[model samples]
Target chain A: MIKGGFAGRILHVNLSEQRTWTEPVDDALARDYVGGLGICIKLASDLIPRGVEPLSPESVFVLGVGPLVGTDLPSSSRMYAVARLPASGTVGWCGAGGYTFGAQLKYAGYDHIIVSGMADKPVYINIEDARVDIRDAGAMWGLGIDDTCESVYRDLDAQAGVIAIGQAGENKSAIAMAFVDRISTLGRGGFGAVMGAKNLKAIVVQGSGGITVSDRKRFNKLSRSLLNSFREYKYLKEWQELGMLKAFPMVPIDVYKRMKERRTACVSCPVGCKEVVRIPDGPFAGLVKHTSSALNLFTPMMYGMQDPWEAVKLITDLDSYGMDMFEFFGLMGMARELAGSGVISLTPEEPEIDLTSFSSMSAWAERIARRQGTGDLLADGFSAVLEKLGNEAKQHAPALIKGIHPYAGPGAALPWDRFGTMELGQVLDPRGPHVGSGGSPTYFAIRPLEVFPKHLKRMGIPENVVDRILGPDRNKLHVGRLLRYSHAWFAMLGSLGICARGQVNRFYNADLCAKAYEAATGIPTSTDDLRKRVDRVWTTFRELNIREGLDASKEALPDQWFRESGFKEYLTGEPLSKKQAEEMKKEYFDEWGWEG
Target chain B: MKYEITYIQENCSGCLRCQLACSRAYARSFQPSAACIKIESRGAEYRIIFTKDCVECGFCADNCLFGALTKTPKEVTA
Candidate 1:
């Protein structure tokens, strides 16, 4: 039996039958899968059939938070959503971090909420403690994410945790996403469309119960120690001041200082990576927007949208529509290129495509959300575009990993000149193109080879495999072999509901995590045991995807990556050939004990 | 020297760390609603409220990283 750190119950909601049931969380399940995305993936694999269409009612949506979420652990307010994504047609997981949602769900006495089957009409699941109701969402069906959340707040408590979708999701746009209280995005591979396909609009949760740890005294000691370490962190002040803008110098510091109203952190987080920005003055004056990070709000500048206010306005509009900004921009960039080359032309009645023009982009957002005219084709994402336009369009298409537009790596929106674990993960991970850096050394920075051993040890890589990862040449590190441990680390962090971002996860080591887990859950877990559990979770996740016909052999680096003259291997500083890239992929699979 | 808890609403990042810490100290569990300190959201800003039961043990203040809450020794006039 589970002693603590879990709500110890799983809420299963069947929308088709309009019924709900609760299942006890068994020790075997918790021990094998851990929690959060690990448990979610396991549940999805068991409940969702292999051949079910991604957008069909048969595809299940699992929302889970780990044992550490409701406790006083720093940056533990993360939740994961797993489903067969409509954009990629692959079972994938996406996570969101913010205040209240994950903790509130735990307080409601549920570690995971699994929703399956379709509702007869537009509805939302209102969960307040044990009372779960499928309420009518007729009035909120067409509203934007902000409005839907506000309506739920009005209907329920203002402090209630709400996951809401907008017009794009209602229309089942492949790029549609759901927002957590209009602050953090929950889905990237169109989980929102899956929710929409089920005629679901939102999920509101409120709980009055508390989360207890098995050994409160020990847990408190660990928590306080971790908190103190974060407090003493040298970069804490700068990190609080700048958030992610400190890492990626995308926006001007003066501009960020002028617009940033306040920094916002998730529950129990010292590093507040999220920010609330206001347009101080201009055409879009008095516009207040809450973004996960400043990087997202200023991303338009990377594409030549010069005005900050315009960028904010465009992003806010996109958020309201519940569209994935990365996919929208990717699709638009490709469409604009094709249109300019006369490879694809807009209807005479449709507005001209110009990514730089806010008005044009705004119109395109609406058109795509509503699936109007040319927007109808764009709503289907790259696969449809490739199918319609043929092989010539493939050359102009943006780098798509797992059939979705990539947000990182070479030729992506946040273009990097060198290859890293994240770059490799873009193609390797079942989920397409995410920024879960997994505490890898080559996430966004190039570090010295000497640092690899220390970082690898911190990531819980066994000493026996350390030499293999370092390889015969002590000067160079094998990225693929290192990535195997990186994935396990990411899985472990996600399972614990810990923030995997560098700012927070940097302070966490495997042994510390193991001790904390033992204290919180009363589960006797050694560092090695913790590593084994996470590796099991990742392997099971991969095996499940493989069962669903996700062929590793088919995965490849986009041609556009090699075409870039500046792109080079992060470790070798030499241009990586296609053969070398393939070898790296093979090494990753070989390390996983899978046939390459 | 006696310490008094002081709150700066502007500095609060709405993380609710203070509330969680307060709850843990008082109830041995983490529950924001059970805490003496509450962070109520008013649009973009957060308003920190201390309930009647707050003894001001200073745990909340200590846990607050943004300096939203602080415990300072009372001034003694000469």
Candidate 2:
């Protein structure tokens, strides 16, 4: 069948066997699930043996590139990867933006790639056009992501898309990530450990050619429209200047303060949200730049510890060593608690509970990465050390999110009436609340029907009309309609490979996207069809997660969400209450066809 | 041809978009395992220097947000 976008082939690389193959993608799959989430899940489902060990050789490593990538569409050059998490036993994946992403992959005559099993020796997989190589990465191991990429480039004749892990993944520590282009990452749920478990050092692919689209005229028109909208949108300016790390300081307002400035999105992203900062004086004193890392970890830690750049550098160092930033900090919480309570005393140059020296903190970060002295306890991870510390650690562990040390304090952003009942719904059914958006009705559709008290309780919104959020159908209120619309949106984008929502979703109008895709590939499409592609992609991911144990019962706001965190929103002293989230979760679940 | 960059090793973040783009523009697939652009980290110096046989394409410089990779006029595409 003719298509507007998509390269139409799926690439499979088997590390254990050191073999690669190409399979034509079915149009039906594209229409239904979209690309990243849908395609990867379905792809993973075929080979995932039930109850497979995450870090074992049998694990599946998956990558997906969509059709809408490249083509100069705002935030469009991105790809998604998913697989069994070596640590959390939950679905794991990350998305990245780069020039090579789908464009290069499509030029190589494939839409996506999935790697399975493990390599017996230290090796890296190289994909160049039709050629493939499993070369040694012996010197690359133990090196940071930066070093690894440099070494790979030195040895290769052609340029390649590189996804590699630092020492943390090599250790299979269960929280490492596949670093992309040294600026973005596929981090979450600890599958970097799975890659390490496979002894597969990295995967690189490069293709040079062209992809043909179904129609060109329509594509051009749409892309132009999107570009113009992007130019006019306020957020696009922010993205172009900052990238994806916008509001870096705001994220940690509840804890940290050293976010020097907000910056722009990643390469090819017009929305510049990432920021760069330099530690004024400390062991890590100097320069450091991060997109999400600066915002997510550095910002929070700075506020909590009253040190910004130092905190960011500490995490960056951990990232270099491939340590899970979450784990690093979570373990620190334990360490800090231990020290403050006198469970452990400062070991020489070590920090005592009273130390404010950032250099000591910087040294402490290195020590943790090197697994020196008590740092080894942290390197062992929170789950183990908490167990070793027994009661106090265990008591504090719940304060952590999913065994992670919570930074924003007890009570995160959840609702009470909706808490157990709501998130429990996402847990029970796998697709989650379909969040990421501040709030989407699809989430409302899937959650428990809004009862008056619960609705009033959770909807704590002072301004929102109760009925608007509660929806007219005490139970059904157009969730299916919204979902269908969402499906179309994802399907359209998936088919086009346009996953740049985070940085420029607010900036680009649909028409510009259409024009870019068309201009690049000569494919012609419409806004309506484009939406279908987006929906298709989202559904595919949702379904994939479902197949991978995403169900209504398994989803819920973390327990801490319902309880009030001791801290309040940084800018607003107004306390965040979970009562509304709990109520919303049920309404969200029901709207999405989730029943618990 | 040479490429200039503001990338301090610690700032690399190890995302590899530069490598991916270099590989794809010159070679065509999104594989950075073999890109011409390389970022080398000097631990003691606290820097990540981008190294590559210069194609002199202004992609990195044009795309740099932090002035990490400053592009010369000759490298910019029309």
Candidate 3:
């Protein structure tokens, strides 16, 4: 049995029956699955019925926190939401980080909350320590995420953790998302639609209990050492000031200097990566928006919106509607193309498809969120929309996997010339395109091939596996083989509720993570043991997806990626070919022991 | 010489590490409400408050990386 860290219980809530029950976390389950997305996958795989409609009452939604959460560990504020997502029709996990939500849920005496069944009317879950109530949320039903959270805070406490969906979710839009504390986004693949189908408006939690560690002395000492390292780091000040803008430089320095109000960090985190910005002087003067990172603020620049104030306003409107910005843009881009080519026609009542005009885009966002007129068809996402418009329209659709848009690769949003772990991950991951790099060396930057062995070793890749990844020449790096280890590393971080962002994960290695886990839970763990456990977790995740009918056949790089010139391999820098891409997928499937 | 915690509310990024450290040191668990230090959120700003049970152990101050808290010797009196 585990000695500490976990809250030691799981809370099951059935909205249809308005019933709640507590189940003791099984020791065997905890030992095998670990926590966070690990346990989430296990529970989802077992409970969600085969071929269950993602929006049906039978679909299960699991929110899980790892043992390290609610502790003094830096950036241990992440939580995972596992559900059969409507966007992809696959059971997927989406993680978000902030203060209160994960930690408070744990302190409220639950490591996981498994929500099932649909309510007859609009309702919200109120969790106050041991008191769990399904309260009426009729008044909050049509409200935006910001207003819903405010209403909950007003009725309860301002410090209460809240996860709420907006109008887009209520309308069951395929691109809908939910927000944590109205800042960090919870779901990406239309998990909000699932919540809407269940009539769950929000979840407010006020936890008074505390989280205890088995070895306090060791945990405290390790925390202190980690904090001291940050204090002495040369870039702490600059990082705190610029956040992600320092690395990406997506936003202009002048605009950032003028608008940035302050930086915020997740629970126990010293690196304040989140930004709170206010419009300094513009048409939307005095407007304030809290973004997960500075990277979000630059999203409009990709669509030709140059004015920062206008961009912020557009982003605010979309966020208020609870829409996935990436999906919305991708769908709108396709819609415009289809209309221009005579494959589809926009009704007179519908707004014009103008990417540059803020008013036009804002109108589209509102219509889509409310599912009005043409928005009804657009709200169902690319695959559904294309299926209605026939093959001619499908030809104009952008490269997509699992019925969702790919955010990176050639001719995509963040175009890159070379394949990396994330590039491969976008194709391989069942959840579709995401930014979870899993601490890969090829995440966002090009690195020297000679240093890959050290990076691989740091991720706890076994020597034999490293040899396999490096191949016979001991020089060429097989991205697919390395992706398997990256997935394992990602599982380890996600299971522990640690931030997998490059800035934070760089401070951690597999050895340190094992020590931290052992110290937190008093469960004896070695680097190899931790690696093996995480590998199991990743394998289970893949197996669950396989059960959902996702296999090597479903995996495909965008055809446009190869058609476009200049794209090359990360290690060899050689031109990419369709045959080479297939080989990568084969290598990945072989490494996972899923070869035919 | 007596030491006291000097708090600068503006410097706090609201990570709540101070509260976690204080609670862990005193209550043997990680609970923000149980901590001597409290970070109250006022919109985008933060207000730090210390409860009467605080022994001025400096754990919160030591753990704060944003210069929000610091332990210093008390001012000498005439």
Candidate 4:
């Protein structure tokens, strides 16, 4: 038996030197941050150079698979990769789902792998317990993500799993994503672009052996209850049914409603509503493609043109090139608006983004992807795109919150039943609500408010956990308190190496978490410990952001949200003004114990 | 008696609980591609087609409340 949960080692692969070494998986680090979060924090402090210029040789890529992964724990199959994000200028992360790497690392007797120092030429890493190699990827270069993974996995002389990027990453598009198992990806924040910049193609893994628990009887006893709890939860059922595809209807209604089909989701998800449609397959023929809710614009445009192929081709190309789809694509909408006024502004606050010319979805995406004419300005992200359009363009691009564009719209106008505000937790953060790791705007939702609070009290958070995060009156903007708690929860999820997206946490909530830990770690860590660990990870990332360019000023939400959302009390139209937002930020900063 | 857990594409969310469970139950490892229960994914479309060659394993169905995994009403285990 493995005993007390852990593979307990991290492998260091120096691509430049073409060597591999082992490092211990620090237990304290595991307790504080777990795999995904820990990899970034540890690598930032250990591997990366503050100003090495991310695309250069100094940048490092660290991929981690959590300890609970590949275990019988619910949804513990996800693995995370971390590097300095080229687009966001901070910690870059891409996580994928599978047992490939997680099992390999365990078999190899390691917890994670960090690849630093770029190779002199393109190469792929092949790993198996007691075996490692740096193989030339010259033949695999320039291929699409799907083809490349197929090629490499087919050629790799072992039972293998491959993680690769496509021509988009090779092109160094910051929006590019890393492709694992050909389908699922670490889709956000341009991790793929960083990989592309590194001139590396893929990492293939295979291993033998399995992690044994301290006590099989106790583990089985706890897991049965955990599984039963998962089967019993309503949220588990909802996620299993809906998945992330829930973001469809938000596309311009006239455009989306026509071509709508049944929605689906990624591996093992419940919210499978992400729609797929076949439009008689013409120019867009055989174009079996799916877009996230944030990219719902494609379906509608596909409908208008009666050509789903063209729309799919355009955005899928964007994803391949490692472009920040949400921010990059949203910028295109803003640019089309700017072209009409022949006006530009550095900041997008005063004048609303009037994207009248964005009427033609075809031209908007094509131009942005190819960086043609107005599209060139959008190749970076919204902040960069606005700069390219000039100060006048800035005024029109006012929808950004902490430079992270709105992934979705307001509650009433939301595409799905739950607008994800409760899950997204940015109702009050200055970086515009989505920047929050947890602490969602669920305070605005119904029913959940009651149950969630009871759970929090059970977890031992202060009675005011909800009211402080989303409460009116704002006695002391308790953003810090909530941030700490949510961060801890996320940390615990990572530490225990479980997936909160499904049943384990929902049915058992804190109860399941405590037991899962005791079952796995043989350590009786409480729910509060999990939350604190998550907070440590979150706070460290927040600090990383602060080091990058975040300050109290940047933390304030944009004026346009209050304007566009026109958020009003149940009876009053009184907007949560910019001044009020500033007050909230200050209070948050003060409570967080930041000097700002 | 045994029951099979067949993952239906329409209801899966890419959560990989089945695989995680399978890895532990059968493999004692957390590898999905290695698990007896597999999650077939369509990321952009957000669909999962879960398949298990195992003959009627009640464990998966017992845990799948989403209707994503069906017990195959007529399915008989031996």
Candidate 5:
């Protein structure tokens, strides 16, 4: 028996051979990799052979939950899905929330599930305890995410948790996502498209087994105190109703208040950040929806829809089709700018190339999902479109860092206030560019500078280090040390299946998570120990990327985005200089002990 | 003092931290179904149900993260 908080089993399914088996999880592997993102990445690095196409049968997809999953610990419902993804052709990982998929997977007696090979036809996997079935999904193919989820759940148990892809994935769109419970997503990195390539439609799970801890009493005590702390958290009520909607400073609070009908939360989430809204009366009257993220709401805004409700509809429609809004916006933005500049001509079959009209955007979204006309060229992602368009059309390509749209860069609509490190974090992330990878600096961006010391201390940073960093000569926003800490912190969170959403996990830190892990698993860990483990996982991840021929030197925002445009730095209000950016990159790499 | 545990259904976020706490106190296992207090989803809303087997131990109340459950004294008959 492997102590506690682990199921001690990993299920392996080979689609090509139609075989299923379970392996006893090695204790040393579990200790070294930790769990979730760390373990999934480590496994993919070991099992997946290089020089093979990402969508090939040999490419492995791993979904894993950590030891903290299924417990009452705050934000313990998160999971990570990883693959040598088609999105950036890098070993990338995406963290998911808003359901009990991770918990159910754990309760079903699995630490992780690896799907290899490819099915001759469309299929889905069903897991209930020791029983695992590979069923034909011929009827479910080409269905929308909602329809796919309902169909699987209706045939199986109503309480069964699902991770399904939609028409986007069926068509193998590089921007496709895996929708979990129809409300949350394993967003970015295009793992869903890999699922499509493997002819896998969905994975349905249900379990009634209980997870036992090493020290039940101590674990219960830790959980109880954490719960009590949440009661005292000031923003709990607002977060319960609005989700991350509350955190967005740009959106008028009244707009969300008018639309919100009810609160629907992820499994085992006390914060209840997810919302269900009903449009009162308009062209889109009585449209009840549980889908809408900051990206979804803002993507339509980029298309010039003034109303938040219209944006809501666009997001809902996009989610149903299982698309990545980040990539879609980049495609649309580039298409509009290029067409208007007379560099490219959109064919007549393409939805009228009006980038600003909601109707045009919606029509275009459908075309992309269906792979019709010009939409077919753009559906695969920014890089593919550039390649298809040839040399002249490459001039019109959107500024994509590492061939993936930036979730936090100038490409996005939301005004992200970062203390410089977010940019480094985005560029350095293995999965091209992402907003959430860098750390929890959004809190630092918004909160008062006086509280920096307290926050650092709470995050388990030693007082001497904190004092040296925040000394009189040092600028308050100077974040070199903080950036280093943030990477390790988030990596650790992913390993432990902890959700690091700013609103829900504002007060969370390595110390608290370490305590919880020790109590439940009898692992006897500390904040320093977790940080070191995070460093190990991150280094191994980098080594894997290097082996796959990824060039670390070219990892940066494109020159045109910086030099061609005179955009002011977010904090300094001065135009960002190339020289300054280069210096920052060098400093960042030095801090992480990486070669420039 | 004799007390009654009142369930405020609206305040629950369906996190089930309370149920886990209760199960730990009563069942010695981390099973939500074994707890005295049950949180059920009625459409988008959550309803808190107290079982007859509940000992009024107040463990659930103490761990109600969102203040969805509270324990108060049972009023004496005049």
Candidate 6:
């Protein structure tokens, strides 16, 4: 039996054979790798062979939570879902937090769940305590995420947490995500398509069991002490009200506030950063939906539609169809660019539709989800969209990192508006063109001198290292060194089931996290110990990518970001030449112990 | 005098931390379903309903980050 915080069980479900089995997690594995993303990555490396198709039955999907998840640690409710990304075919990892799923799984006497093989027909997995059932999802198939969740809840427990995909996954859209309780999602990596390939509709978990911590008193004391910091967070009220939207600052707050009906939070989160709005009495009356995200909200606004209600509608439609907002936004921008250059006279299948309007974008998004006509081409991903649109569209096509869309590459913004560390991390991420992989938060763009120490402290870097970086000329501080810390820090958090929100990091550091871990799991861990474990996990991740023949040689930012004109480095306001950019990448790779 | 955890519904962010805290205090485990205080959401609003299981312990209010839940001395006991 597993002691400490772990339930000691690894539930392996094979849909292809419709069999389920439980094995005791090797204590050595937990001791060495920690839990969640760490264990998931280690398992994925061993279970999945090289050159295996991501969507094939041979590919694996691993869901795990850390030892802290079921404890009272703040923001401990998280699940790391990982797979061979169908979008980029690289090692993809998504850390998601919700109110119930991870905790419920832990309470159900499980440390992790590994699913492999494909089901013969549409189905969903139901887990209640020790009982596991692969139920038919024929009736619920093709339903939107919300409806599917509601229907599944009706058939099961209302309290059961549902991680279901919309039609986007059923159709296997590469950009589709696995939506968690209509609140948060496994960020990227085409995990939804992986589920669709398995014919798995949803995973419902409900547990009435208990989680035992090694030292409850110490755990409670440590957790309770952190509450003050969370409450006193400078942006607490703002985050509670605006969440991520506050970080990006899009459409005046008054605009969203008018439609803002209420704010909600994930499981065990002190910062309720999610907002739900209802358009009270308009042509679109009683339309209730949650905001997509900061960058996602920017998509509708880019088309000259500023109405918060309209944006909410577009976001909901995108979610219902299981469309990726970034990819959709990129496609819309490319289409407009193609049309603007007089390359193609844009004519809609429905001639009455204003092809440039937000509604038209929504129409195209829906078509992409359903894979109908023009949506069929666009749904195949950005490269496919460009190919069918011909050479003009290809020229206008935004540079994609690897095969997937870049969230915010250097080309996406003017140099001043862009972040150097973040952009560099984007290309370096094994997942390719993703932000969350590097472990830095979106709020890292704050005034450097003021936030540097705090950022360093949060990552638990030694004061000596901080002095080394910020010494002499703060302008020439090597950002590559900081990126190395970020990679390790994020890898550690992923293994620990910790949420990656800015405030969470601000309130807790590696020292406090070690205490929490030690108290929860009787595993004596210190900052140094955890740091070593992080290095191991990160090295293993890099090794996995290398084994797949995905290395730094293939990494490159868009040409626009490297262009010298109208560009300046974000930190020093100095011109960022192409040679300097190449040198920076080399420095980053060297920090990771990689050779050019 | 009797005191019970009192909730300001509007201040609740629906984080459910109070429920986790309460469950820990009562059940000695992290179980939200067994907690005395329940946070229900409708649109953007959340309602905190205290159940009979509540022992008048202020753990939930004490852990509430937004002061959404609080306990003060009341002269009359229910």
Per residue, candidate 5 scores C-alpha lDDT tens digits across A39-70 of: 88888888888866778888888889888888
DockQ of 2: 0.08
Candidate 6, chain A: TM-score against the reference: 0.93
The residue ranges of model 1 lying beyond 4 angstroms of the native Cα positions read A341-343, B74-78
Better of 4 and 6 by lDDT: 6
* Worst window of 10 by summed lDDT in candidate 3 chain A: A437-446
Winning candidate number (DockQ): 3
Tens-place lDDT per residue, model 6, A1-596, is 23577878899999999999999889888878888888888888887778888889988888888888877778877788778877777877777775578888888888788899999999999999899999999998989887887686666523677788888888888778888876667747578888888999999888777787888889888987887778777878877777677776767877666677666666677886665777766567788776434335445665466665666677788887666777777666666666678765545573223434667777777877887765566566765565566776677777677766666644442123445566667777777776665555323554566567777777878787666555655444555666777888887777777787665766778888788878888887898898888788888887888888786555775666655553356566676676766776776667667774
- Cα RMSD (angstroms) for every candidate in the order listed: 1.7, 8.6, 1.7, 6.2, 2.7, 2.9
The most accurate candidate by lDDT is 1
Candidate 1 docks with a DockQ of: 0.77
Q: Between which residue pairs do clashes occur in model 6?
A: A98-A267, A99-A267, A262-B44
lDDT of each residue in A50-157, candidate 2, tens digit only: 667777777786777766653334456667666777444555445555434445566666777887878888888777777878878787877887678767666665
The TM-score measured for candidate 1 stands at: 0.97
Q: What share of the true interface contacts does each candidate keep?
A: 0.74, 0.02, 0.80, 0.43, 0.46, 0.62
Tell me candidate 6's fraction of native contacts, as a decimal between 0 and 1. 0.62
The regions of model 3 sitting more than 4 angstroms off are: A471-474, A572-574, B75-78
Model 5 Cα lDDT, one tens digit per residue, B1-78: 556888778767667777777776777766676788877654456788889998887878776656688889788797
Better of 2 and 3 by TM-score: 3
Tens digits of lDDT, candidate 1, B38-62 = 8888678899988999886888988
Model 6: docking quality category: medium
TM-score of chain A of 3: 0.97
Candidate 2 stretches with Cα past 4 Å from truth are A2-4, A99-102, A155-159, A234-239, A242-268, A273-297, A300-303, A306-308, A338-392, A398-496, A499-503, A508-556, A564-580, B1-78
DockQ of each: 0.77, 0.08, 0.80, 0.32, 0.47, 0.59
Q: Is the docking of candidate 4 incorrect, acceptable, medium or high quality?
A: acceptable
